[model samples]
Target: MGVRWILAAGLWLAGCATSPPPSGLPDSLDVSSRHELTEVPFFPQRDYQCGPASLAMTLAWSGLKVTPEDLKPQVYSAKREGSLPPDMIAAARRRGRIAYPVTSTADLLREVAAGHPVIVLQRLESFWQTQWHYAVVIGYDLERREIVLHSGAEERLAMALDAFEQTWKPWGYWGLVTMDPRRLPASAEPKKYVKAVLGLERTQRWQEAEQAYSSALARWPHHLTAWIGLGNSRYALGNLAGAEQAFRSAVRAKPDSGIPYNNLAHVLMEMNRTEEALAVIRQAIRLGGPQISVYKKTLAEIQRRRNS
Candidate 1:
């Protein structure tokens, strides 16, 4: 992130991806041609602190009071030259918010329209000197064909959408936003949120995972993965009853899914409901079609518990 003195001014694009942008913006965005999230706060990047600065601003806007100085150790990599996207996303999850990728311009715009600012990676250099930098997109003007960003020392930096897309292309147009788990991305599928939260839990952040899943359930009541995730988190936290309820909800949400049956059976065995456990284990064995070994292990475990 040697982006301190690298003024991205007058940088002409030598190469831009030929892929087209998103088809259409969301209808809810009252795009009378121009829009700006004036209330979105900003923090200018100090040297290679763009990653931290951008995250601090976006997270603060999402309901956290964090400064870039506070986030350096968590996101900045002195050895790697800069912070990676995964690290930034992980840091957001560690801070108890869902940090999911933005796939398209429409997605970025939708976030702005929904009052969320997006952190985007861009090439702030000429084609000959590619400087990878992080910036926060705060607004856009479709009629003027431009987007606004909080980049470097400049707040409210504006660039033609074409130039923005070009600069973003080198980085695969990568961007992300932090938001309440109860809120879903406007231009994305509900499943994306599940993956992001589950990814956090996979990193061993169970409390955050539990909250994320709860939010998912509140927003999309039938999100089977969320119920399963909530149950797993509860189980890990030693809440057998809560885990049992979540697993039961999963079964009700998606009766065909084999995972809930196996998990529910295990929880019942843990609660010393051996007879009920045995009943569910059989159902798990039958429904857990592909992951035969999983339910088989659960069956053996339950039998061993009863014998003990």
Candidate 2:
């Protein structure tokens, strides 16, 4: 190639390599705030094992002494080539921690400032040749506009949040954090955590599910789903009294909804309170919730038990 042609190509590549990252941090973020959770252990990822490495870091901080190698089968996807969010969440729940996605940059920063290391995905290459990366965020210096991450082989990778946004923003600025059941996110809606607990119930992991639900209730006593879910966990564990109280709380939270009454009726029958069961079932039927037939069957069963 000609000397001038080579020089032109080199300059073009240099500009691409030094391209400035995107900008736009949330206005509500405290730019002067500086915080770091140094307690989270760093796990340097090997090869394309960022998923396992990041998961190990967060899980370890949440009180599990697990390693990346121990999580490969659960969080590592050999078929798709990398772990997805759902897999990461399931792995954390399996270990008895409440893990959920952070919905915004502010929420992520909130978690970090609160001493929780957050695992986030960042884009590592050109737009046309995108490379996905997972990194654990252990700290942030909002005054400097930098976010500290446990990225790749680096222990404390300080990245500009705006620049980090370029790499981390879409994928919905995807970030996940695993925390004790009693701890809740500062800026996140109560429903976010409640939904996470419900997700656990769906998978039949009701063991620690009650802890999360109770935690949710402690934070927002008016949360209907928390009450209902707590009832569900109690019922699953054969605690009829606790189940009944939860359902009653659910009933108080949303008087217009008949679901809690129906649930409470079933628990009453389980307790051999036949007359009370029939009365509650009748109230649920009067409200005409979605499950009419189910309520009718419950009422019939109570009557049959009472007749004999």
- Residue 189 accuracy (lDDT) in model 1: 61
User: Taking the tens digit of each residue's C-alpha lDDT, what string does model 1 give over 1-308?
Assistant: 11011000122221111114533456665434666777777787776778888899889888788999999898887765577777788789888778888967777887777777888888766555656788889888887889999887889989999888877776567889887665665554668878888776767777777887887788789988888889888887888999999989988998986778888888888899999988987987787576768778778877887898
Worst 10 residues of 1 by lDDT: 1-10
Error of 1 at 178 (Å): 1.1
Q: What is the C-alpha RMSD of each candidate to the true structure, in Å?
A: 9.1, 13.1
RMSD of 1: 9.1
Segments in model 1 whose C-alpha atoms lie over 4 Å from true places: 1-32
User: Evaluated with lDDT, which candidate comes out highest?
Assistant: 1
